[model samples]
Target: MPFTPFHMGAGLAAKALAGRHFSVLTFGIAQLAMDIEPLVGMLRDAPVLHGPTHTYLGAVPIACVTAALAPWLCRPLLRRWNQEVRHYRMPWLQESERWSPQVVLASALAGTFSHVLLDSVMHLDIRPWAPWSDTNGLYATISLSALHLLCMAGMAGGALGWVALQWLRSRRAAQRQRHNP
Candidate 1:
């Protein structure tokens, strides 16, 4: 999709928040969240599971458990980021208000699940249905060359189509609400 990084992140984060507030967004949120992890692949640089954990088998447990634990991860993981180059800083909230566990978890879980699913569609090597078997249940082959460009192309096309459909539906819904109201 042509969505900016912020929009994508916000979309998936919203999905995480949706678990506690299920409505029209449940599916969209899931899609957004699943899409997030695949895009942000800092791990891709490392010699990790076929380009930053794109394996379907790897994404599922991560999705479900992460979704289940989303509430926990979102509640201000107060830790110190002590870089040798920079001064040590602790991550804390600006306000004194405490976060709700359920809400926090919901945000994280949705984002995680969405990330896994989207990654699977994006990469054929990702075995979304793995752990059940030794082989990766990837939808696409992992040749990592121009020969397999079609695989990624298809995934990108699907995402674009999905985004277009969603935008159209939202526009129609807004029109309906505006006219009817």
Candidate 2:
């Protein structure tokens, strides 16, 4: 799942559910950070692609570091994203670049943990409980197609839900304005 957009489905779903409590940008950064080890391994031709960083033990530190740094990294990127949204007249896609420390930390944790969980199911080499165990009990727990489908479903459902919420908010605001005017 290295460099794959599949992980974003979960992030989007989380954003839809948690609203202001979840930062999808932070979550995306954490996901990228989690896959760095595997990307390096692939580049170096190492035997173990999914190494320590793909474990629960490994994810904590990565999540913490990502959370600590995400605010700085995300601000400019989010500003650019919002700019594009405004230029495209997609107000519904606009989002606050600023995130609370709590939201950053939670999003980072969620991203790293979910990355590990999703990869564990698809890759045979991922020892998710590593240091304490080398077993991949989650490997192939479900079919590959099913996993992909689930991720896609999450992406679709989340996008629709977010748009629907935005539409409802706008409608209510319009109704209030009409009544007041």
Candidate 3:
């Protein structure tokens, strides 16, 4: 993807599918973490723009670091967002002081791995299994147009599913309020 939003499609899909079991914030952090090496190389005009960080082997450490740090980093932001966004109170953000280790690990791993696979599909320079092989057979296997569409489709599907889930929750809340009153 050009930046990282293309990767967010999958993260959002994870959120919609797994609900509280998936932490989209941690997943997003991992996406940004994995791209740091490429960004540094781009700024320095290095010979290898993708570098080792773009590989599966390199992503492991990055994902681990991101998973460990994301909770603390996200806490204050989530608190502030919860305060500001009164109508859409985020359950996860309602209190970011705590998080499930399993959720964070799952999200971070998913994020990093997906990022490598997605980039490998488009970037000819990406050797995801480097040191073992330099060839990127996955590259250009599908058209760029198709890849973009796939990412967009994931985003659209996630958005729709989230909206439906939210609507159902709200409706149930309203029904409970009416019955109680």
- Tell me, by lDDT, which candidate is best: 2
Lowest-lDDT window of 10 residues in candidate 1? 88-97
* Candidate 1, lDDT over the whole model: 0.41
Q: Each model's TM-score? A: 0.34, 0.91, 0.86
Give the per-residue lDDT digits (tens) of candidate 3, residues 76-146. Answer: 87777678656576442243445788878888999999999999998988999987989888998999889
- Residue 64 lDDT in candidate 3: 92
Runs of candidate 2 with Cα error greater than 4 angstroms are 177-181
Give candidate 1's root-mean-square deviation (CA, Å): 12.2
TM-score quality measure for candidate 3: 0.86
lDDT of each: 0.41, 0.90, 0.82
**Best by TM-score, which number?**
2
TM-score of 1: 0.34
Query: For residues 1-181, what per-residue lDDT tens digits would candidate 2 score against the true structure?
Result: 3789888889989988887789888999999999899889989998889988999999999999999999999999989988998898877667788888999999999999999999999999899998999999989999999998899988888888877876677678889999999
lDDT of 1 by residue, 91-129 (tens): 111111234545444544444454444444444445545
Which 10-residue window in model 2 sums to the lowest lDDT? 162-171
| Candidate 1 stretches greater than 4 Å from native | 1-97, 133-181
User: Distance (Å) between predicted and true CA of 90, model 2?
Assistant: 3.7
